[model samples]
Target: MNTSTPSRHRRATRHIRAVIQILSTAMLGILLLLNITPLLAYAQSETDVTELGVVKLANALEEGKITSVEAVQEYLDRIKAYDKKIGDKPGLNAIVTLNQHALEEAAELDKERASGHIRGPLHGIPVLVKDNINTADMPTSQGNQALATYQPKQDATAVQRLKYAGAIVLGKTNMAEFAMFWDTVSSVNGRTYNPYDPTKNINGSSGGTGAAIAASLAAIGLGTESCGSITDVSSFTNLVGFRPTVGLGSMAGVDYNPLGDAIGPLALSVEDAAMLLDVLAGTDPKDPWTSEADSHKSDSYLASLKGSTLKGARIGYVIAPFGGYDYSPGPESDGIFSTTEDAISVLEAQGATVVKIPLNRSWWNKYAPQNASFWATTGHENFFVRTEATWPKGLAELTEPKDAINFGDIVKGSPKMEKTAVEWVMGDDKQPRDEAGFTAAVNARHTFAQGVDELFTSYKLDALAYPTVAAPPAKVHENPGELLDSEQFGTHCGWANFTGRPVVSVPVGFADHFPVGLSMLGSQFGDVKLLGFAYNLEQAAPHRKTPELTPSLLHTAGSTGTTASSDPSTGSDEASSGNAPFTSSSGMSPSAVALSLAAVLAAAIVLISLFVRRRKK
Candidate 1:
């Protein structure tokens, strides 16, 4: 029967099976390694859509290098990953409500692009709107718990324009409740931390937008400024903020002070801000204040961008605003002053004349007091009435405490609101609301406007430059309301608002780990010129730096994201970090690592297969 031969055959079969099993194990390992490579590379290739400026994103879309859906998804993923909470790192509570239909809208826009119908420069760009700005698709909570469910019937004029330009509404960002304070904290969303330093507060009422844009949660943001909300937040977050002349942009559908408020853009660069302004600046039938917008409008704000815009231009360095003589400097004064001086030097090198001018102390003292009184008394009453009338129907009828809907009730409901109310009342020396004071305040504004005109004429100045905030951003307080600055009116930003002049705040540099912004103030309706000058300075100095805490999550080829680079030539470090590709902690980007792993896996698989065949033969 040959039993020995049969046993030998069985042993031979077992050995062959064992070899096959070992080869299979090796192949699986190789396959796993190979799979990981592409995954890693794909991750590395994932673009941080946040870093792309409006124009750059538009160009990419036009070139079919990216899709609106991909861009929108990246922002959504970033928001989901870091908006509410990042890993151990303090979360930026920037967004209050994300547009549920963002992806769908983006898909539609992408389809439109495929059909050869481009909306505009902002087509398919995702933007964040300050919660205080009305949005039909999202609740206009104004970062107030009481108004948490309140949704507007229509979008704000600015939002409408953004949508008209094919810009996707990513979401509404948190803001000061009722747009009442400077710090971006509210009863609904808690507080938004500074992207650069979590311990510091993001100046509001546009603080959420500032933080969101700084963190790259959205491509650009829309902020409504009453006082220095826009500029202060921008200054603190190292962004470029534009506050147009009071009436240049519509205040319709936005909570604002008719005399002081304006809607503008907060962006990573001056050019992007200008592009937004180009779309947003126009006459609005709903906002009578914009009646003169057509006359004030330029052919194209984007066209005004030129390196030569600053050449032969006269810029006034208003020292008093930055604590030159009258006001004392804060602890961060040296750093602030140094960066400001450096900015001035950059302007000088750009062939612009920089003059040291003293702020009109006498004028500010005499009229500013009356204006303050008026703003607190008659001005407050007017704003309160208007806001009440325009408040969401649900908010307007709220009566939990029988008077919860009124401004006084809302103020008394919370200690923070009460404190802000006290400051507002005491700000004007507790002056009683009177027609005489109101008239006087109205006259003061006109007088201040005239004075601004006179100063520019006398100095032959193109713009007045000063620190956006008197000091660096104040540290965030345990009591969010405690972070509100009562002395904001004494700063340069308030003066610009009072006179209804257009102002642009550009990040100059970092001082004491906090960003310092330089503001350029121009005559009323001189927004185009202001933007042009800002563009020139931005190109020359380029001071905007991406916050370290909110670095890009993915590496992409030729991403024009800002980085901290020290270049002696520009006297600033806001430019690119050079042509070298970005790398992750692994020394290679995820994509590069994946490709290397893929090659290794292929070689390993080939070798294993060859060995197995040779052994089998």
Candidate 2:
């Protein structure tokens, strides 16, 4: 009698289990669909390729969605639209000379890609190098009209490396005349204005690259630094400027002082900068300073760009370097200090332990000024000798210049050179030309480096953070020399140059409508770690903003037959290759998103199957 009742109960239980299984499977399917919608939307979104980093660009190139020629042309179109004067609005005079064969070169790279011979991450990417860094195709003007026609017979070591890695040399960017001034005013290219604000100056001598990069004139740029040149210009222009350890990259084709000169990247993002560095860093026979680069260089700087790089890292904040109301109290200084504090908080939130580490102000005061003077003199001497030795005879034969043949000649030819020459001559007179004073300055720098090392060792720090330039950029009309009167000018950045350490300047926030930069200084040969740390900070709080005046071109893919609108007020047409595999603003590539969706679907299927089986039991 109980058997019949049990049979009926068993059948009822089986029916209930079947219903539950069906509901669970349906719910799982709905959840999977909901989860993948955003991913699909991201994959289909229209993203401007001009805003892409090196990795994305490379992936696009590999995927055959876009050709190198198209990318190069897009950059060229952007330059044409906004680089020069447009109507009454002052243009960003960032580029000195356009590469005459850029398109042809890009076509060749496209051919290479088609042949399945990929060079590296930089393959087919366009790059802008500062005028001082020699390129075989363009003149190494050093921003002096005197050398406007002086092309080098061979590429600079860094340039050669970039090219070997399949990067196209887009052009040379303008810089201070002979890289002599902080403001990027030149005898050849005139001046470079800030992309963020036309009325403001793009601090130099890397200002040209900074402005160009900020405005998306090129994919990325190469900038050389002596003292605050790289950091200053990058900070003011809201870019990521990396000045690697002096010996990290070759200075063969660059006209820089051996003591403090470095060539690094100015990019829209930290990862791109790191990619550039990965290609640039290594020993070069022409650059004796890089004799140890092979040993010091990382296998891949880009590999270190993890978002968790800041986790468990110790970062020391040096307040003296960031001059604010505490030292030179004022509205501007207060604003800078406030911005810096906010930046430190962001770092702390990103898992970094921030601690205030007071630098030896007396040590900085005693040597920073003298070191600046010393490097300026020695750097000029090196520049003069190097230029005269390496000047391209063919180009010199073709075009005769009115200005002097060398720095010495330039000093006699132009009044602009007078002040700098006097400084050089007086510096030599005071220190006997790289002898007593030079040695003293070097020792002072070594001491400073030791102090920094000790601080890091004691705290087990990953990096030292500060405002790249103590104060905001001086106005366009403000003389850099005059700005030095504020006591904060160059104080924070000069020490990095003097000590030959790696420092990266990244946009922190805004101050009075202008961009403010936070600098991260690392030990010698610590370029990768420094870049990683900066990348982490950048990913956490992306402070870099695209300038309103130089908005992203609507035709960033160059597939559109029509060019970008010349009028700044009107945006360009939707990107020409909108149908091409998309990359989201968050930098997730279409392929990556697809893969993620596939994985999620698989996991969901497994969960649904498990639920269905359990209910059926």
Candidate 3:
């Protein structure tokens, strides 16, 4: 963690520049303007079972058409055929550990259906989960070596709910290391690329789950967020990611959660996300906090999935909040934001009134810094640090422990985990604060929380909406120097986390070939209403397009013809988007440390040369 090693690799910067030039020319927005059919048209063109989500598949299965195993197998085959093609270049590595017993479990479900015992809504559906959630049948490694073989004695409460609903656990998805970073670079599993562009970041720490659902690796996946981990990455990966109100879903059996991290659903369709949320939302005696949950804890969340649910809702938009960090808003980010802005327009068209709101930067700056401390004290501690202090000697080496964790870094070797250690103590370097800073930050967080409460009360608003990120996905290893522009967006989206309010990130549009998300921020515990608005907007925008893995015109053509055309972008999808435009005025200006030093050296060189010439004379 040398804080001063040039923002990125020199080679990565060159590649990013080249890709940006190509993308700027062949932007997705241009294609949308030309009236090219969206990627979703593929489902309309064919009766592909893969195109159908869990609920539809369940109906088909119940009607004696498609067997449960058949549906699960189709998703597995999809993972095999299109995993790498859609841009997660190495193909889709969405799945970390495939349940060897998936086929067997599906067989059992089919038999149960034959026995006339229908489980429920998620019955017979194959669902993927973020690695941090525990499952009795499989190892739940929170993407760490330390718990490589760790297997929970029981399924996490959420997983249990899925099982009760008759969903088959397909596998454990990949994630960021200990869910520490937003990039899916795990010490154990390498990286999880964006399903749309493998070369770019899928958006972590819940990236694998987002990519899995977007790519249809599984009908739905569960992703957890401490801050923007779920919502931000889901926005980038073109999926629906929900962060429920605190203590809504039972955290029992989840590997992490010293902080109040809530696990929610990521899916291709918002309805599917809602279904999963319904199954998972309930009071659990094991978690004392659940006792304080809103009285609506037991409400049927799925009942709010009506298409007309958004009518008459009041929505606020944050247009300028995140624009500050975007140096090069990729085609995906740009397209998605425009699409979302247009979506808000459409919502207005559909009778929902929209209002513009200027964000409070002072409030954001005050409380936002505590997110690292919150995450570290909560989820990070329960999952990793606590394990170190409690686990038996050589726990990972025990008899085929289900979770595929590699703990050598934590236990056996005194590895140079100083970087990881530092993160545990502080947070990400880009946003760091000290003890006093954190204390002041905690107070600031309360003030900001109060502001949000006031906004909710004053406006009596249903929800606030904004683009998930300043730009779309960037290639992995892109020069970090360029991402300064959209930092404010990250800051803005992140404020909700500090406030402990529920936020839903739905894929509404694409920008610069990357996926941009529209977020719905609601009154505390207004998860259902936020989701309702999203569902309505989703229909209006209906722009979910599958990325064409290969560079083919047909891919860019109507979905029925071929995959989408490939957009030129360099680096990994998980890396930072190329250099964001720097603003000279406004905000904490980032001094160009490297460039400034280079200038200083050049001046000294000229002075020395002049002195040398004088001496020679």
Runs off by more than 4 Å, candidate 1: 1-46, 322-326, 366-404, 408-438, 486-490, 556-564, 567-617
Against the hidden reference, what TM-scores do the models get? Answer: 0.81, 0.75, 0.71
Worst 10 residues of 3 by lDDT: 574-583
**lDDT digits (tens) for residues 1-617 of candidate 2:** 36696577668667656765666576566546544433332244344455565767777778777777777766775686578874456678898899999888988888888888888778899888888887777778777655677767777888889988999989989887666667777767677888777776677778889888887777888888876788888888878889999898988878656567888888888888888888998989887888999999988888778633787888999765522223554566666777778889888997889989754556456434333344434434444444543553432333234232434444343344435423543343212254665676667667656756767899888888888776666665544333222332634765577578899988777767677888989888988778888988877677665665665444323342322212211233323133322334545543355556566656765665666566556
| lDDT (tens digit, per residue) of candidate 1 on 444-475 | 67766676777789999988888887676666
Give the winner by lDDT: 1 or 2: 1
lDDT of 1: 0.73
Each prediction's whole-model lDDT (CA)? 0.73, 0.70, 0.63
Best by TM-score: 1
lDDT of 3 by residue, 1-617 (tens): 66443444444555555555555445444444432222222222223454466666667777877676766666665665555443333665667788888878988998988998888888789999888888877777777655556667767888988999999999998887667665775655666767566666666788778777776667788888876778888787767778888777787767554444778888777787788888888788766656666475636777777733667788877753322323344454445556677667878987888888765555445434334243233223324433322243455443333242223334332232235533452342222224555465456556667767766677777887777765545467653112211232342455466677888877665555567778888877778877888888777666455544411111112232211222223222321111112212332112222233334545655565555455445
Ranking by TM-score: 1, 2, 3
